[model samples]
Target: AQSVSQHNHHVILSEAASLELGCNYSYGGTVNLFWYVQYPGQHLQLLLKYFSGDPLVKGIKGFEAEFIKSKFSFNLRKPSVQWSDTAEYFCAGLDYGGSQGNLIFGKGTKLSVKP
Candidate 1:
């Protein structure tokens, strides 16, 4: 079965630091990619997504991700991160045909931004 991978288990940075979270997907066919963020006590919110068209898509806030089909990778990036950006990031994958079913999420990356 295809899966999403987030290599960073935990990330820490001071406010205003740059952030880049790596993500990799293992789907053989067409797939949809997404990045979701969950605040300390809030529900998950969609940060960005890529279904088609441009491989480089911008998400809410300053978050952005680039889809590299050849490498089956969709990595999230932010030139600068703030304390308010502290949250759990999840990279998700959904088979285009099997979507409507469920979203396969990564193990989750906990980001801690110190003020």
Candidate 2:
């Protein structure tokens, strides 16, 4: 089965530090990629997504992700991060070849932004 993998399980950085969380998906056919963030006590929120059109898509709160089909990667990036950005980020992929709701997700990357 296709899956998603995040390069880092935990990441730490000071406020204002640049952030990049590596994410790769292993789906043979057309796929949709997404980044979801969950704060300490909040529900999981959509950070960014890539379905079609532009390879690079920007999402809420200065977050963006590039869909590099050549590498099967949809890495998330932010020029600078704030303490409030600290959260658990998940990389997910929806496979078009499978049944509906066939979404695979990575283990998740915990981002800790220090002030």
Question: Whole-model Cα lDDT per candidate?
Answer: 0.92, 0.92
User: Taking the tens digit of each residue's C-alpha lDDT, what string does model 1 give over 1-115?
Assistant: 7899999999999988889999999977667899999999999999999999999999999899999999889999999999999999999998655436478999999999999
State candidate 2's TM-score: 0.95
TM-score against native, each model: 0.94, 0.95
lDDT string for model 2 (23-81, tens) is 99887767799999999999989998888999999999999999999999999999999
How far residue 77's Cα lies from its native spot in candidate 1, in Å, is 0.5
Clash pairs of candidate 1?
none
RMSD of each: 1.3, 1.1
Clashes per model (N, Cα, C within 3 A) = 0, 0
* Count of clashing pairs, candidate 1: 0
> lDDT of candidate 2 vs native?
0.92
**Which regions in candidate 2 have their CA more than 4 angstroms from the true location?**
97-99
